[model samples]
Target: MTCTIFYSTEMPNEQAKVTGGIPTKPMRWAVDYVVKTPDGRTVVQGEKTIQRATFEELRAVMNHTIGEIGDEVGNEATFVSWRATAHGGKKKNRKGGKRK
Candidate 1:
């Protein structure tokens, strides 16, 4: 069976401090995922949160979710397509101009 997945990551406002001269906020990654069949039928969908916003952690969550979906579907589901997006802080202005 072929399935498509859509996922997005959002950073919460909660923060933690680390040992460093510069102040940094501890980011928590919240992932929302949806699994759909070929006919646009949603098989499963839910949200998961990771304490640390690292690539490895995110990947692990995604993999585990997909596995769960496959088991629930009762078939070998192949990932035909997927989409991902990240929502976070605003981008800094890079234009070199005098402040108004």
Candidate 2:
């Protein structure tokens, strides 16, 4: 089985760090990940706080999580088509209808 992981986050701004009044740090980023089928539809996803001190440990944790989900699903799910049409896009009428 294969999986892809994507990460995204917003860093705290200097202004907030200095001027904002908070009892603690503004934010912390845990490792957020998504698991998808072979053709790109999401199967399972989750986030876990950075607990391990090394890269290998973190990778092992993520792999184990994904493996558990895979085992439960029995690896029979098919990939879903992810194509989407544009919203409010213009299209010509084949019947020669009038345009507003």
Candidate 3:
């Protein structure tokens, strides 16, 4: 069996503006991932939030995730591809709306 892995980093976002709200810290970086079989069937997927947003943390999480995938798919499974990306950070304004 062959599989594909997709993962990415979740960027932090600033605190939102709200009335009578206590200021809270911005979100930390997180990793989101997905594993799929050759037939485009989703095997496993999840997101993990980490304290740090470094490459080392990302690598560690990825390795752990892959191991979990292996356990789920068995030893015959071969990774056919990998896709990674980064998401979040700044919120974009909606169309025809005022820019912050």
Candidate 4:
């Protein structure tokens, strides 16, 4: 059996900058979100949140998991489950739990 997984990438707007000592127009974004209130009725709204990741966060998590599984197999074998979101980023051994 195979399972389908969906991942979302969130990025912040390009921060405004003063170029050549000139100011530019501000950028705006529209979003939707949900909220809960005292009664069954809930307040749902969408707002912006500061972006906290680039895009490799998922890849790092996957690599870490693979490293852990490799350790369980008791070998220096590289976990084939590794994936990369970037073409040329530094590759580091997955950090896994130590074996006895």
- Output the number of the TM-score-best candidate: 1
Residue lDDT tens for model 4, 1-100: 1111122112124222111211122212122223333353433323332122233343344445445544654534421321121222333556774545
lDDT of each residue in 1-100, candidate 2, tens digit only: 1122232222233111112221121122245555456565677655556432233444455557656766766764342111111112234587868877
Residue-pair clashes per candidate: 0, 0, 0, 6
What C-alpha lDDT do the candidate models reach, one value each? Answer: 0.48, 0.39, 0.46, 0.30
Residue by residue across 20-75, what tens digits does model 3's lDDT show?
22113332444555666656676766666655344444456667767777787873
Better by lDDT, candidate 4 or 2: 2
> Once superposed on the true structure, which residue ranges of model 4 sit more than 4 Å away at CA?
1-54, 76-79, 82-100
TM-score of each: 0.47, 0.39, 0.43, 0.25
Candidate 2 stretches greater than 4 Å from native? 1-29, 38-41, 76-100
- Lowest lDDT 10-mer window, candidate 2? 80-89
lDDT order of candidates, top first: 1, 3, 2, 4
The predicted structure with the larger TM-score, 2 or 4, is 2
Better candidate number, 3 or 4, judged by lDDT: 3
* Global Cα lDDT for candidate 2: 0.39
